[model samples]
Target chain A: MLQAQYVDGRSTRVRTVSLSVSGTDLVITADDLQRAEPLAGVVFDEQLGNAPRRVRLADGAFCEVRDLDGLRALMASARLRDGWVDRAQRHLPWVLMSVVGCVALVAAGYRWGLPWGARMLAQRLPPAISAMLSRQTLKALDGGMLLPSQLDGARQASLRSQFQALRLPDGEPIRWTLLFRRSPALGANAFTLPDGTIVLLDDLVAQLDNDQQVMAVLAHELGHAQGRHGMQLLLRSSAVGAFLAFYLGDFSQLLAAAPAALAQARYSQSLEWQADEYGSAVMRANGMSPALLADALRLLSKSHHDAAGVSYLTSHPPTAERMRRLEELAQLRPVQPSH
Target chain B: MDQTTANAPQPTAAPARQPQPILFTGRGSEYFGIWIVNLLLTIVTLGIYSSWAKVRRLQYFYRHTELAGSTFDFHGRPLRMFYGRLIALGMLLIYSYSVRLHSLVTLLVLALLALVMPWLLRNSLRFRLYNTSWRGTRFHFRGTVAGAYRVFLLNGFLTMITLYIMAPFMHQRLKSYQHDNSWFGRTRCSFHAGAGRFYLVYLLVLAAIIGFFVVLSMAGVFNAFASINAAQHGGGRVDPSAIFRTMLITYGVAILFGVSIGPAFHALINNLVWNNTRIGEHRLECRMSPVKLAWITLTNLLLLVPTIGLFTPWAAVRLAKYQLESVRLLPASDLQEFVDAEPESPGAVGEEAATAFDFDISL
Candidate 1:
């Protein structure tokens, strides 16, 4: 017999009752044994720590029991077994295996799966949608960060013609337009919009020693355009951001955005290497020295340190590594002098 | 069983007058196991199992918290919570994506969220309390949506207008609204804290922060600031160490202020709220020490940072143990006189919406 307190569903009155499990039924008796209720459809609450387990009866009355072992015996004899979740919670080895599996899966997803998915998705998206997105971004940039080209109109025309004349290694004719812009904030940089518009900053062109170096920089930007790196980066970061916020309780907005930005920077580093490889290939196919790309990178890295107090090392890592690879490529394939 | 002595246990005279302190019997090791399993399962299911995980976690905490030898229980269904989370995630996706489309759309979404926030908050409180029970009697929140809007939004706007001088008063009003409208087994809970007390706490925190910064500025720390100014005005010969020193001083001051003032205010407010609260004839007594709470918090953070948050379960258990141990209840009548009362259940939608928007108002 178990000591319990029973509450009737209609009234808020607590009555002292004696309970005993008889086969499949729970026999409840009054203090004096005058009244008794044998409950058939009895439901026991899930065991939570040392809390009193509630036994809900079919007739709407309920009993609270504190005897753990007795309740467990009753539940088992009644054929009411604990669920798989309860078993999982009690078993330590399974729990440890689950923890290891979860960690491995998350790490793998972060390292490769998300970026690969983003790349595939970006490639599948239509050019028209990417162009629209680029247009909106350029309009925003023009309104704040970018200024009209400070280079002379004749120089701009000559650079545009030279950029158009360069051919890619795939033998497919390049369809791209060159634009010149002056952005003091950006200092010396060249980037491509999704619509194949390569914007060469005035500082970058002025810093280069020869026209071949400028063309090499343009070739790298074209590589980004071909790969649609911008769209892929945007999609990948958003996916990672959503995943982080879901797993970890949504922290502050700035805290959530920081990790996504860092992940994107890491992705950008890999994209930069790919573009460097493409730039080297273009330089070699056109009978120009791949060393021109390396020379431009070295000059930019130097000027980057001199002009800005901010270190570009974190955002664009592997500059030194890519320069080394470019030098190796140049040595492997000697440049053919074409006047 | 103890029922053998039930016939002789008739206490017809006077009941015990001494107040009983609440007990937290949860062990860090046991809780750590549960937490790790919950985290693993939640991740394995791609966050779909988080609702179940949350329920299990809450149940653990609730069951381990004992008052008068009977522990509390949470009766929320995991499937209901899962549906709530799905709706919340959908709304969050829409809101986050809308910001990239246009500024006007973002503004519209913000305004819409603001309008519905009070309703969500009220419902969340109701849902949370309705699912919580002690001794088979469920806790209930009777706060209305209109009342929530008045206390949360209208007074919030006034506090902003007064440049946060009215913030303490607004906080008191909200607390009063929440406490006064809550019930346990047909007995209402009441709050009797004054805005003046809250104001004093806030003012002291503000003064301490200001005084720390003032003292730092008066010290030679401002010499770094002067050097940075000189560097800016002079040629590009900026001494990096001077800038670094300034940043170091700023960060140190900020951390010191947070460590000292944040815990002090938290302790004071918690003490005030719990001490002034009454459930029917029973009154709560809080004995939380600000210095002790601060020490525990700082040490927990210290341990947590070194472990990369692996000690979170232990830290949480420690904090809960301290808080629950400090609280006691003075019963004015026989504890057994209180009967079980169940209220209408509030569904999970409101709680999920509040969570989705991250509208976690610490009380």
Candidate 2:
């Protein structure tokens, strides 16, 4: 135990003082040591006031007074140590626990909830109805319709050739149908309907500068189909629909109002990013540069230059940012194109 | 203090060292154990008093920890488990009553209300759960139950129009909203990922799995037919059950396909989320490879089939560890702090002189 004594009123003005310490630094304020004793081995100077009122105790331990000088020295020492460990320590535990805990909760939910949900859903349906719906839906959407005879013929031929080129994992050839529609209002729109029916509007065809870009866009849309994005989304919607219908009897009005409802919904940025990555990968696998997709976006943004506020495309992100991201991903080449 | 003052003139003190590794690893297993214990307590208490347990766990992990020379503490008290259960019970009663009435109007009202309750509870609980901060600063979570209702309506709407071509985007946005609205004191959090890469992988994997089963079914058919043909030709007793046997074979093939691929898909989705994590100033870097994820998934899938899916509980524990182990904190280096005091000046002259008269070391 080492000790040093100082009075509170030795200043010419005569006032009180207080002292505090943080970490290894002792801090003394201008109010401190005003009345302190000037004992033997204790040296004092007016010039030394500019420096910290440092004192050496009996055990040879030293401390800076709590005043501004003391705070400065303490802060300086902190800078030298690079106090991230101390700072990060507060967040470390909560973050780690939260991550682990969240995963655990979701896992638990999945374990008990998934099978229960699955069985419950399965039990509600007659196998006959399920099978019929599946087959009928597939046939209805699978490449059966197109507008304009000449355009239809060319697209059919292109699709036939493309489908034949694709091989399933079990070495079977893929069978598909392409549907085309002429829509003046929907400029350059294309999508795969829920049943694997790839629909390309005449407007979409008109905007393609090259076969590769067209193929890339088509491939990206096809990737969504092949990935069962349509299926999951439909299944989820169906669930929501069924729940709504069961609860509220006759949700036709709600179904009709869905587009307006969706217009107000905001998705997490990550989900948007995920879809972008998926689309780009699909484009890459089909032997098309994602840059072309980027170029396609640039064209769309330019075409819709006059659209008020943020359009759906703009809401996704700026075209330049999307393109840059796609290009960065494209650098990791030789990845499987289809998967 | 003297040594610091002597060497302080050189702004490039000690060659300007980098930040040191904090805690090596923040092992959360202890808190996880605490969570489990509290969860069990909640269950045992019939969901009545678990609020205390939740607060206990939160305080132990969050409030007691040190950050930036300040002790972080939760200012808001957590809700009791009993209250949570009561809410659940209330919702259940309303749902059952609506179903029993079987009327269009009642059902609609119940359905709309049922959808809104979860959103409401989430906001209220979050409001209570997350309050104040690392230093003297306060934390504010700018979210409301209405936002949750809006999300529900919006998700419903977009899903209808795009016919779900935009679903992945919707799901992503919901996740981002949850993350962003969550606060650490007052700092807003954000996250991102490579665009749509996993969606492609999902399709490929699904195609492969489906294709595998189809081939297996075809093989079964061929084998069964060949057996029947041989038995008939030999004038031997052909099992009258051969037709049924072939059907069984197809069913078996389908189940086998599910058992093999289910876990892999699960692992893939889990790994994707884990690998793509972003929070505050830290990015979660993952070390788990695709192969590792696939293996974990396969194991879980196999276990899932044998235990009639009961093994899922234990499997979740394993999955969580794998995911957690893969995550590493990558701190952002953009933050810089500035000090305002003059280099040559003594910082403590005026205040020390005023306090010189009071000398109470014992007190």
Candidate 3:
């Protein structure tokens, strides 16, 4: 219950509005204001309904009450009368945004997502092919068994020692046979097969600066064996490139690259660099100068200049690049003392 | 004595109204159980379980949720939600046939439908969420998934033009929309308005790192070329050794391009998305310094490399909890008048009569 307040310098108190509730609606009537003013054209609700109800005072001012108790509460609490501002509703914009957010995720999943998934699937095919090629190549080399007893004593000992150190990712130490062939058809070259077989041509071994140079270069080949670079490349290429080959109407192009890819296995520039760095690290760890490997590259480049105009190093990139990388590693102070 | 007196309750003050406890009717265990069951079922059925499970999950959330002691009921039909998937699948089938037969028009039609199907489905879901009620109190969930789609499309368009430097700002604008649009009945949601600057910082730092790599590549190429030329023709006596040195330089270039640049970019993107976000009263806020965030993301990403993909779920859960716990709501109290009716006993002051005596003035 609210106490009525007296007006300043007036004999009468301020008028009170009475509320009547029915269901959800509240009806408000000011009896004193009606008696005093007798306003025209204002329809008075004889009964209150459940809907929101509004009442106009004698002064032509208006107020709305949703229910009986609401009307009473408003009169009691409204100490300082203030106007409220209602602009455009925010609900529509919010609804719009949540939809957009979900749509973006879905779109991203579709456009960029599915293609990557397909590529991942395609990437699984080449390792099988490379492993097959490596095993087949090794089997062929192993059949050409040249024993150390057939070799000259000094060269046989060095080859035997190097062969013992060569190992594959599967923990099988490589066996090498010396092929003393001087034919132009099978020129100076070295290659490894999948089943722990390393083949060194007589001419290629004879051309190296020293036994260590041959060892450093052989270690790089062994890196290819350890990393399974040939197999990985073969698998990746077959997976991605087979589709490309079919789309281009020529599978032979990929087939031609496959043999070369396996024989030399020119790694991605990163892998090649990693192998070089790894070779240098191993050389230094084994009580040899890392620069000795770079020196070996310099010697190989000289031999290429003398014979083929461009070195084997110059086939992919110039010799200077390989030398610079090896030199950089050599310059770094070894964290562990050289053995 | 003075300190104790100051701490005492003020005399003649009206008793403070006790705040209503926020009862989390949606239990974590219940939600987790539903998720686990759905996950198991999905795995068992080879993902076919998602269709029925999604409908059930939504129904469970709708049934258990309460506002003003009224549980909200979802009136939506279960089968209708698969409309999006159906439309997408249908369009894809048509498109595949068209492509196989070399029909350009059918392909275009398929593309257009693919763009529009999600939009239509979003509106349907929004309507369902909005029309639900808790007890007698209606749940007025704001924001349509469709509207969010449009904003994303527009933001994507803007970001592409700006070379993606505008992405963080665009993301923030999207958050604002999500915040402002959400409402409980007529009460509108609001957000902390000061987080845009932080989002911008994240964007700029990410942009700078990318720009650095692009510049670095160009510099590397030039350096490689210059070294080659210098070695080839530096003196009157043309040193053949210069060519061999050039071969060695390629190895170093490969390392920088392969390892350093790729990991750095991944780190930058991860940091911006992770560190910048904090759920405010209405919207999410990004407060982290982009550089610091990038560093942390990179470190974690590097560490996670050994775990394969197993660590991803753990990271996702942590991020979700962090984001959800940061969320705060504006203290907008619901105002409703409760009037107790009097019994119809004789000579009793009827509730209506007593209420009438008390002036229920309008304001």
- Interface root-mean-square deviation of model 2 in angstroms is 18.8
Task: Give the better candidate number (2 or 3) by lDDT.
Answer: 2
lDDT of 3 by residue, B68-186 (tens): 33233443333444444454456556665455443467668666765764455345434453545332222233555667666666676688899977777776666555555644333
- Runs in model 3 deviating more than 4 A are A1-339, B1-37, B52-84, B88-103, B114-118, B121-177, B190-203, B211-313, B330-363
Q: What would the per-residue lDDT of candidate 2 be over residues B244-286, giving only the tens digit for each residue? A: 7877877876765554465566556555554565546655455
Model 2 Cα shift for residue B172 (angstroms): 1.7
Docking class of 3: incorrect
Enumerate the candidates' DockQ scores in order: 0.30, 0.01, 0.01
Weakest ten-residue segment in model 1 chain B by summed lDDT: B344-353
Per-residue lDDT over B108-209 for candidate 1, one digit per residue giving the tens place of the 0 to 100 score: 986787787687678767767777877656677888778999998899889999999899999999999999999875679999999998898888778877
Off by over 4 Å in 2: A1-339, B1-44, B47-81, B114-147, B160-165, B193-209, B229-277, B280-282, B287-316, B334-363
Interface RMSD (Å) of candidate 3: 24.7
**For every candidate, what share of the true interface contacts is present?**
0.26, 0.00, 0.00
